[model samples]
Target: MAGTAGSGSSPLSAGGDGDDSLYPIAVLIDELRNEDVQLRLNSIKKLSTIALALGVERTRTELLPFLTDTIYDEDEVLLALAEQLGNFTGLVGGPDFAHCLLDSVRLLAVEACVSIAQLLSQDDVEVLVMPTLRQAAEDKSWRVRYMVADKFSELQKAVGPKITLNDLIPAFQNLLKDCEAEVRAAAAHKVKELCENLPSEDRETIIMNQILPYIKELVSDTNQHVKTALASVIMGLSTILGKENTIEHLLPLFLAQLKDECPEVRLNIISNLDCVNEVIGIRQLSQSLLPAIVELAEDAKWRVRLAIIEYMPLLAGQLGMEFFDEKLNSLCMAWLVDHVYAIREAATNNLMKLVQKFGTEWAQNTIVPKVLVMANDPNYLHRMTTLFCINALSEACGREITTKQMLPIVLKMAGDQVANVRFNVAKSLQKIGPLLDTDALQGEVKLVLQKLGQDEDMDVKYFAQEAISVLALA
Candidate 1:
């Protein structure tokens, strides 16, 4: 039994043996000082993995100083040093070991520059990593500086609120203007994070003076990616601000994106309206955002139109029926006939809400005729929504519209190309059964229920059975 277990632990086997190997540890420690960069690196990696598996405390008493020294050894060996330090520092060294750890971090943070920042980030061990990070935020290398901006973000979460905002805030502000676009992009994302959780007063001050100006400058950045990042930050801040008690200062920036050259940016800008309305007042929505919403309602991009549909109800509350009188009502009506199934579907749902809000006059004037046309659409989804829309419109207008106008259209859709339509149309006719004074279309309605009762989809089959049961009760 002992020999069988030992066989599984053999290093010569491709599979990892479960047995402890003490020989590799001593060999790697000796190779750590090797002049050959590759030999030292491979040795350091082996030792680091051993330390990770064994314990950092076990490795630290022997390996800490050597890892620190390697950061300045040469660029070729720096990566090896960084990887080892990441593993070593992350271990449970505690406060008593802070001096050796802090000293090593200083060299990486200030002098070794870029390589050290990568080390600090790679390990991201808050206890072993932050002191070096705090110092390196002042590094002379733009690459090092950019890296610090990123590490500060990760460390801030790990370190909690211990590091002063004063230390990180300026570094990020400077990074926002870095000559490298990649650095600028990274800094923008970091700054956005910082602003989110920064103490409320501090965040407000930064928004008023620092962040807002930086965003305006960054929004027009020649780098489209940077502009996109800035746009996202603006949108996030707008949402945060929209919920904040004090929002007078943030509204202008939120509104500016409505005209952004990028359609996506414009869409994000509009999305913040509800938040803004929640914070400021509905009047700001009615007065400031109406035209942009109208323009977006007709947007060539289906996504942008979808966004408009999402916000239209909010705007309607502020601007009232006058806003949708010609602009929104007519646009959705036209969309009901759209070739895109999603657009047609969205139009049907929104029209249901619209009829519910404005009643039959609005449905008759704006939606009823178009939805009736869609009852025959080729797209299965479109046909389903069209039938659902007629049912919804009848409910919105009461049974009078069902008896007077919609029953024939509902019966016609009972044989729709899609199964859901066949089910829903039958179900919709049953809802109007008690309300129908005459049996003018009673035979057609019976045929719909008969066909639906045998539908393959269980939902259709059940609703069809219910429709038949209701007809029998009548």
Candidate 2:
């Protein structure tokens, strides 16, 4: 009798003391077929309440089919139906009949189901949530499988270790190799998080035996986005697996990814070098690392180049001055004159960090001269970069080096043809002033700032006067 519902009225309309309370259910059912989209969506959202009033058997026979029929409703309505039905397994005669509501979750509602799976009994989770997840993982639509992959880490935590190992692992491998690039990319992105959440006793074994081969496959995935996604997290496995396994298994994948055709994939590998360096040491990595690093430092993408410059001090400490000068030192200096202002700015800071790492004497011998020579570059921007470099290097290089090696170049640049160079030179003196001895500040720096204070350019003279105030050289 209740099966004849959704025609026009709630089944409770027949006979009940609660008919007055159930009047809203009739209105909700009536609204389910309403032409207005939000009305139908609102009705779908309260579906669990309607099912509760209708009782278990009627919910199964009436509500399930009505939702199935309304699958063609507006996407928002269907999305709401998907969310409501995920929690409906309990309302629809419990776990045995959870299967009748399967299409909603397997297709459009996978995320909500993961949240509800926690509320199920173990038997129900295996019976209801696991099978639904298993099928969703293999669903015909890439979007469904993608939903499963995106939430795979959350699903792993929900199902506990035994189910995750038995059911989710095999499904996960298929997802990582999914024919659609989007699904594979989603799975590739979860590799670190999935490995991280695996049971501690089995975490290493699972990553090495089960997860890694697919990860290796992903490292060369024909899709750049997949490789890029994997590159972002793959270095993380080094910490999870420990040094020996990382050196043996992961190092090769990292080296390969470092040379990946896509700049983002290559950039991702470079950015996370510290992850591997902490585990196996960077000297052992230097052979392959240097070439890929050099290639990325000069990469056509400015962001890629920027990532390498940021990582230079870490690379410098790991490889040490001998190897760094032999290989990477020029790459650091090359960045100072890089066409992109952001790159050049990072390069200037990089010199300061390098001076801190390698000390002032080596900077005098190595970095200081190159920065000083840039003052004479044909491009006025490079001359400005020289002043930027001095500002950064002053704190690290100290008073002797700032006054002796660095200050003369800054003072000389004050007379440059470009007002921008002159203004930055004034800013640089204010920055480096505290680093200079009183004799240098009073005699040389004061005179140069006084000369710059009278410049025709407003910006140059404003900064020149500001520098005099900040340094108290007025």
Candidate 3:
């Protein structure tokens, strides 16, 4: 066999001509096992030449198994073999012989296993593919376990309902609790998908009785990534499980994640609040909503705090004006002067949405005074934030509030010491001009623009002149 394998006369080795004729299969085999990595890599690159000389049957029986054994070789050698695989189709006698190569294709082997299982007879799948996947699901490598967990829904689909309920469900249970965090995260992400794809006949029973228990464990999984992945899609289960099951089984888990230490996890849960709201109603949701609100509102990450501020109007609308004033209104005001500019800006936009939700009276009596009082704030950024709020609020507050309530602040800031603040005041005046009646636009607004247009700073003067032209007060 070694003598027959050593021949290099095969047609597939034609390009080598006389060059690699010196490197026969027997010599290459020795080199593949050679202590030197460069020599092994050279042998791996010439893999198809060796396969051609060995013929299809021997390549399947002998060559592929050898490559599989040596897969743990240097990364470069493995990469060389991988690059050679796409060209191996005819060398391995085409697609029918492709499965022989599947075991060697580790990168996408999990998906390949499920795909191949679909084409085989059910008896073969039960007897053959099931055992291989079961082994892969518990493989010592976390990567292997992750792939099994990641592709599990597709595997369940290919194997039919009975086998899935009997075999894959138990395997999925182990995967969801796999010791590796990556494996658990992968499994956690698949929880809803796997449940959704379960046979309609027994899905609810399987989820309520079998899957929900592990999901409960996963929701509190120590790894943030796992919890984040779960939170992103877990709410979809509300409709599937119905209002009763969601309230009894999942709502606590949802609220727990909303207060999770991880910002991404909290954001994901908040993003899906509508799903839970539809299932449980706003009155029931409000009971747990405030704690989640306070938790996120005070998050150390500005982006997280900014996210909660963006949700305030919707929260305020559902919780109503009285509850908002008591619970959430202070948080919104605090955000107007938040240390982060992005938070202050989002807070400005949030007020517009709230005014739109609750009307101009809410803006005037509830929010307008608090926002306007920031003109006296000692910090310039807070003072600037006051102007930004005026810009955002002017349109929503309408002619009466714009002319009487908010317009006085813009005119006062136009004489301020800071050029940036003066320039922003010019911008605010222009933004609110259309919202004002002709008298205010041509009177107090025109005087502020004329004073700012002659200011020492170029930016303040430029913006002031632009506002004059824009408001047609020139």
Q: Compared with the true structure, what per-residue lDDT tens digits does model 1 show for residues 1-474?
A: 001222222222232334447556645655655666677667656755656654655445534544444334554455445444544445635434433444543334433232233444333434454556655655555556666666556545544443435455666677788788877877777666777867776667666576667766776787866766666666556555544523455555555667666776776666555556666665555566667667777778887777777666655655568656745667767776666677776776777777767778877766677677766767776776766677556767666676667887787776666777777777787776766654543566666777777877788888888877876733
- Measured with C-alpha atoms, the lDDT of residue 1 in candidate 2 is 6
TM-score of every model?
0.63, 0.84, 0.79
In order, what lDDT does every prediction score?
A: 0.61, 0.83, 0.80
- Each prediction's total of clashing residue pairs, residues at least 3 apart in sequence or on different chains, is 1, 0, 0
For residues 1-474, could you state the per-residue lDDT of candidate 3 as single tens digits?
011222243322344435555356767776766778787778778887788877888777767766665556544555466557645656777656656666665453566567566766677678756766777887777767887888888888888888888989999999888899999898888888888898888889999999999999988899999999999989989878888888888888988888888888888888777777788787778786667778789888999998898778778777788878888889988988888889988999998899999999888999999989999888889999998988898888888888888889889887788889999999988888888888888788898899899999999999999999998898
In model 2, the clashing pairs are none
Clashing pairs in 3: none
Model 1 vs. true fold: TM:
0.63
Which residue runs of candidate 2 sit more than 4 Å off their true CA positions?
Answer: 1-5, 8-18, 21-26, 46-76, 85-106, 120-122, 199-209, 358-365, 456-459, 472-474
Task: Name model 1 segments beyond 4 Å from true.
Answer: 1-21, 24-49, 52-58, 68-92, 102-131, 134-147, 151-165, 190-192, 201-203, 235-249, 310-327, 353-370, 373-388, 391-405, 412-442, 447-474
Q: How far is each candidate from the true structure, as Cα RMSD in Å?
A: 9.2, 4.0, 5.3
RMSD versus native structure for model 3: 5.3
